[model samples]
Target: MTAACLMSTYQPLALSFNKGLGTRLWDQDGREYLDAVAGVAVTNVGHSHPKIVAAISEQAGLLLHTSNLYSIDWQRQLAQKLTRLAGMDRAFFNNSGAEANETALKIARLHGWKKGIEQPLVVVMENAFHGRTLGTLSASDGPAVRLGFNKLPGDFVKVPFGDLNALEHVRKAHGSRIVAVLMEPIQGESGVQLAPSGYLKAVRDLCKRWGWLLMLDEIQTGIGRTGQWFAFQHEGIVPDVMTLAKGLGNGIPIGACLARGKAADLFTPGSHGSTFGGNPLACRVACTVLEIIEEQHLRENAREQGERLLTRLRMELADDPNVLAIRGQGLMIGIELKQPIRDLTMIAAREHGLLINVTRGQTIRLLPPLTIDEREVEMIVRGITRILKTA
Candidate 1:
């Protein structure tokens, strides 16, 4: 009906949308779409969740921002909850995934400097997506995202993701200079690539052996997206430092860097801080998001629905030779194709009343809300299967 007016940096389809509920999004034309993107994995509790809306409305009327100088009760409460859930001792909140990751990089640098290492290196994995900030950009290995930015920070040791042998080999060679091993439980922006079985445990043990901090970037996979509060929980392993954003605040601009043990003590008062981090309103909303996730049993819903969705895709698309692989956990899933299918994103949206994303060129990533139900799961699988078959 009308041309898009948004900036060029983002490529929103010509469909104008309005409201969303549960797993469905409605456009201005009253067309409904089964949403599997979940605002890039931010709205884990689902759009317009009653509790989250109430928290935002209530907190907005109360105190919003007062800097970090005074004691913000809500911020402290959220920090406590996140740290407890993460099995970490301390937390520093920011406003986005990049900020959270920026804090983690700072910690690694500080840890390295403390030990008299001039050039403290961080071990990162290929296809990792940390964030867009300068330091986090250096940490990310995605070619398209990293393109045109020359002379990126040189301290990152790039290793193939899920390659435990490569990790061990690099650890032995770079142990003394390495400060941290930063990775994502699942490579989100690179197409929901999950590490191999027992891979996280092996990495954790390797980090311990080398006395390097294990920092997990759970921005897209956290907040029950992976059938647990955090993806690493599936492996029953813990990281020394972790970065969180995306669904943490249910769309309220909040990120956090959680640390445990010695890593927890690395950040002093002036060593790191954020102006809008842990603000009253954002923290209050994040707390409510966590509450609703637990109260509504979204984790269980994600596991059950995700299993059904994954099974249906494999079974339905099994005979289709174009579909290469189906891999991922919980709501974070990816369907790889034999060839690049980036164009299929728009095709799915326009033709099938669905919204899905193509990442790493050839893989379709599904990040449905944790609150998605069985019916919606079936719709998503059916819609995508149709698109793949026709394409």
Candidate 2:
């Protein structure tokens, strides 16, 4: 197959995997892997989850696409469930995380336009990854990701992650022009960088005081992966707008921008839309995925199993100075090393039958399935211990 035909552009892992279930992946060569990365955090319910697969299969047999012009019962039902889970008034469905974020950005712009602000600005954090769309690319922090894209969207004021003082400084300088503050609860791209304790509460307080919208990009941290339905729950803060995708349908390509309070009323009829946003098939799968997560107590499973994995890793590799940090919440863990270990990602996979991922050159990211068993966790730890000790 040609690279042009495939959407995966020069990706390192040329995976020829044929089958997967739960936490295991088997390639064409008949080798099994303990999948830890979970397809970059999209396969939260796990690959080929029976309920999700059945729902998709059944829905496909019935109706595939009925553009958003008609009423979709499944879409409405899924929206209600998502609203209840995220404590939002409404949701606008899209195709992927970038589209969800694009919708959120439009909501912010509309809010600013309503306020009579000529040049609206949204405050974004350092090391935050929104998505790869033009608008989201402009908002993202990596220069390499934005390289060669001429005239990227302007008016965003960048601030350091977890720094309330920098946020306050920006607010002081551009309070009138700013419409929203957009960020990820945990900076997944920058080595899973977490905010300081009480940072989110402070952000909420500031947003309320300054009359700015607080938007969270939960594309990677939402669903049951973070031991909660959303990571913001851990901080006890509710955003005016929250963007979700990645794990919503367990790889079904659904994104949502949930709006609350004033922001909810910004997007009026005919203002913004998508053709296949809330089609019956995707919505049905999403609804089923949410149900399975709840019914199986995967959130608690993520919490319990994540703690066990992290604890064992810390205890086992405590003596290695190269292991600088092991930090994460629930199943979203990052093992930061003293130096760049990009090759370790390949080594772990090829030699030990483990599938993992590295980010920011030095941090190994783990987005294991929420259904990972204790034995699987031990297997992962054992593999890492061997690789780290020898490498």
Error of 1 at 303 (Å): 0.9
Counting only residues 3 or more apart in sequence or on different chains, how many pairs clash (N, Cα, C under 3 Å) in candidate 1?
0
Backbone clashes in model 1, listed as residue pairs: none
Please give, for residues 38-157, the per-residue lDDT of candidate 2 as tens digits.
998888888898888889888999998989888899999999999999889999999999999999999999999999998999999888889888899888988778778868878788
- Residues 1-391, candidate 1: write the lDDT tens digits: 2345755566666777799887788999889888899889998988888888888888789878999988999989998999899999999999999999999898889889889999889999998889887788988886778788978878999999999888878867986999989999999888788888999999999889888899999998899998999999999999999999999988889999999998889887788788889999999999999999999999999898888989999999999888889988988999988987657888998899999988878889999889888778888988988898788
TM-score attained by model 2? 0.97
What is model 1's C-alpha RMSD? 1.7
lDDT of each: 0.89, 0.91
Best by lDDT: 2
**TM-score for all models, in order of appearance:** 0.96, 0.97
Worst lDDT window (10 residues) for model 1? 1-10
